[model samples]
Target: MAKIWVFAEVNNGKVDTAALEILTKARELGGEVEAVALGPGSTDAAKELGQYGATTVYASDDEVYADYVAQPAAHALHELVKEHAPELILFATNYDSRDIAGRLSARTGSTLMSNCFDILGTDKARTTIFGGATVVDVALEGTPKIALVRPKSFEPEASGGEANVMPVEVDIPDDLKKAKRVERHEEQASGPKLEEAPIVISGGRGLQDASNFELLDQLAGAIGNAAVGATRAVVDAGWVPYAYQIGQTGTTVKPGVYIAFGISGATQHIVGMKGAKTIIAVNKDEDAPIFQIADLGIVGDALKILPQLIEEIKTRKG
Candidate 1:
């Protein structure tokens, strides 16, 4: 039986959804699925990985990795791969995973396929091309191949099992920690994060300016469990942070409900949100390209409609 190794990323003592998603699919591949958890919450993340079908969890939360040494993390992963010799190694598309996967690919001499949504057979994976207009199949040759799976690409599940946690420690070369973290600045984020939110209200250039995004914020507050998102134009114009961007160059969202206000639905923008279950577009132009894919197209000014809509929703709930 071919063994599969999944590197699980931990955030605030929880296993990242992307890591759980890949682990669920890894079980479907009919093999021994082992997970590697890193960082401060490695212990908690290992248990969560086990619940998602990871049989053996190699945990490394030693000071070198806990301190966030990217190079040492990559080195430790290389050493594990050299010892275990798993056929397939999976990673999430997050920053740290991409960094480690790239370096490990170079170290192992195995090609790394990034931005994959699905894994086919054991070695082949499926990815999108041409701004998500085309489907491409990629098959890797040789052992210990790496695949970086996109976030929210698969469903996360729990199998109600416990993992055999194995502690892994590696020596960190002195030169690798040359870069030290000076300070970490975080924006004040409210409500559910955009990527994981089931309902998203996104605005584009049509909102006019940064202050206009308040309309979306108010609506999101009223709608309950909704996250506000922004188009590339608005993000580039500094109306919102890049974290709120949903477009070809930004996050790929497949929310249950997607409401677009003032968005023209350019091909670039559509690539990111086309997978949504229901799309509602509000634009002044009846001929807006956004209407082409929208399940409900409203031809009107959003500014005027939103206030009334918010009031009506509040009244109905009351």
Candidate 2:
């Protein structure tokens, strides 16, 4: 039987949703789920992981774990894996997770599968694919296999009862100790997370001016619970923050409804949002590439169409 290890991420004492998603899948694999949380105040963090099906939660509470740097956290997880000898390791496919996954793979000589959307199993091994396309099946050649799972790929399953939290003590590796976090900075924004939002309203070059984004905000607000997204061009033009950008080089979103206002639908952008359940495009150019994949398309200026759409939604709501 292979025991599964999941990295439970915490920042400012708040647990990330990605950790819950990984534990949910770990349970489905029929393996013993163990979660590792490394931070200054991680006791409460570890307990939260238990509510989501983690059988054993390892909490590392040390000053070295105070920062969210990837190296120290990876070292802590590496130590836990050495002691427990888990058959598989799981991580969320975020920027920090990618760094930690790479470091851990190099340390343990484990096979790495990154950005896996689905895990298929035959009696022999597990398989996953990348880019929401191309299926590659892999059987581990080593004792433990590691996989970085994409967020929003799987729905989290809540544990019916309380979870068991265990505190594990391990000496921090010297190599990781050498690297310390001197400063921490965060970009504060108020809104729903783009990946978690039910509806996403995005704009492209067709909008022409950065100030025109207020139209998108208006439409998004009308939709209620909609998030604003932008194309690479718009982001490069400084129309929106990089976090709101969606494309091959940006965040991949799978919202229930994706509304593209004035976007031309480059393949790079299309691939990122192709997983959306419904796509609607508003552009004057009927030949815009976005129309090919859009479920509904309007041939008009987005600036004009957006306000009308917002009014219609408001009227319907009332």
Best by lDDT: 1
Candidate 1 — what's its lDDT?
0.87
lDDT (tens digit, per residue) of candidate 1 on 1-318? 999989998866778888899999999999899999877779767888899999999897665665654788888888889888999999988877888889889999998998898999679999888767799999899988999888777888888879999888777788877655555565647899888789999999988878988989999999899999988999999989988988766787889999999999887888889989999999999999999999999999988888888899899989
lDDT of every model, 2 decimals? 0.87, 0.79
Number of the predicted model whose TM-score against the real structure is largest = 1
Structural similarity to truth (TM-score) of each candidate = 0.93, 0.87
Alpha carbon deviation, residue 207, candidate 1 (Å) = 1.0
Looking at model 2, which ten-residue stretch has the lowest summed lDDT? 121-130
Candidate 2 residue-pair clash tally: 0
Q: Give per-residue lDDT, candidate 2, residue 318.
A: 95
Candidate 2 lDDT over 139-201, as tens digits, reads: 556756788777766788888545577776767667666656787666744678888788999
Off by over 4 Å in 1: none
